[model samples]
Target: MSKRNRASVSLPKGVHRVISRGREYFYYQIGRGTDHEGDRIKLPNDPRSPEFWQAVRQAQGLIGQVPADTIGALIDAYETAWPGLPRKLTEGTREQYRRSLKVVRTAWGDLQASSLKPSHVQALIEKLGANTPGSANNVLDALRAMCRWACGPRELLDRDPTQGVVHFDRGEGHRPWTPEQLSYADEHLTGMLRRAYVLARYTGQRASDIIRLGWTDVDDGGFGLRQKKTGVRPWCPIFPELDTEMSKWERRPGPFLLQDNGRPFTTNQLWKVFNAAREETPLDGAVWHGLRANAAIRLRQANHSIAAICDMLGMSPPIVER
Candidate 1:
């Protein structure tokens, strides 16, 4: 109770003692420049006990030994190297990898690539699958590809962490847009959004390819472009509906679908615009990609052969069959 007895006692530089409700509590700062920066560990036991010192020592050891070969580093290297390889990744595939890598980095960016075990990969997949199994599987695929790249060219690791890991079963698949939903969009969405929807339904191309369609791509009676995702060049005929939609807009030198400011839509911009229109309709569980499936189904309903469908959609026979 005297001033001399209450005088501060020395502890570790990063450790501090405080009194709350007349009880002393000890906490240790894990330090800066690490993933655990600003993190503090409270020692429940008495500071005079051996256990408290043991915990302190362990926390101190992790302070300045951050690993160099982190998951973030490996992903950065992979992104840089992937485009330069002889067999380069496609633009769409690269975008997919980038998105999945973002999710993985949020969870374990600073974690050492060499320290990852199959159990760690499995745990991540399980945690992600609880919310969205399809997304979990996509992340697993991205990790597997990154690990393979690291082993093959980067030589960052000798073994794959994703080797024994399995993906969650995403039951079923994307549903095709129904006629009623299409009608709803036609009535609700106007101008550029409507044209985009019409173009997707007619062409059966991915959103990436659709966004790149320009007036120059149009020819005598159809438009042709090499599909970005599959590398297949498809020349699809200009159906009556698509032609009618095109005639309503003045031809510009740029993309077929332009923003009000006369610029083509970036992938994100296109999705935002399309989703905004979609939200105004009475459809549920419908998506832009489903329009591609609708095109394939429409071709099938018209008694087209699998080969014809594949040619029209710029897809493989197996994908058409599916």
Candidate 2:
């Protein structure tokens, strides 16, 4: 392939030109010293053409006319400011927000934040609730936080659209696995699946944390780490059951659990394997997370106080109480 000639053509203060694949494309920057400073509006036309100039002026006019306090803009600003905030978002939480943001964008991305009515939010929630109430509730919660941030010292919005939007009741989530179900899983699950199950049951940690556990995490008759979801560092004594399970387990190169190819299990991989194991058992509605609940219940049965249980599970007292 011949080397393509590239040239920089000076345009307006906020506009520039670049050549890629022998085609010139123009980009207009929003401005300097703003959340979207580096963001550029791409104009897919010949930069020297009259149509291109017309398009640039039209885009500039639209940018000037549209308020910067749209729902999409506020979401961007909130994300840009999130890292500097006192309350930090966990990785899992950030991922959840990213997913929820897609839903929010689909509904009210371009709507002016201050002009959004409670009824609009309520309608979106109702529509989402019809199919996936839990997901709808999650989106509602995320939107509420974003709106609250907008309404804070920034005063991006005069009112919050999520102010009175009711979240659909999802009810108590995944239940604890019964002793018999636990025994069934113990007997039936093998290899990485069995190790993951035992680890989750013993540590009362989420699947994401449990799958990431390694030999380094085990020390001084216990294993501990700062949880990814909550950022709480929990050190729990290794139970006899977990010890026995680990004793018989073959050590893997990476994480405690490995896929057939010996790579550490991704979240989706672990879920698929766990679901396969669940399919073998007679237990219905028993998820991998249910083991965490089962572990908490076992601690409760052993007469551990709520506070102690909270510490063991790395959960807040309110959550454990719930």
**Predicted structure with the largest TM-score when compared to the true one:** 2
Point out where model 2 deviates above 4 Å: 1-67, 251-253
Report model 1's TM-score to 2 decimal places: 0.73
Residue range 50-166, candidate 2, lDDT tens digits = 334445565676553434556766676566555555688887788888899889977877787777898988988898899999899989988998888777676777877787678
Error of 1 at 15 (Å): 39
Per-residue lDDT, model 2, residue 103, is 91
Predictions: Cα RMSD each = 15.3, 9.8
lDDT of candidate 1 over 1-322, digit per residue (tens):
2222323233667777767886677788856456767678786334433345556655677565444477765665566455345576777677788999999888888787788888988998999899999989989998998888678644788899999888886554678888899889878878878878888999888888888998899877888888877677887788898899888878768788888897888778988877665664566668778888888888888899998788778987866777
Backbone clashes under 3 angstroms, per model: 0, 0
Model 2: lDDT to the true structure = 0.75
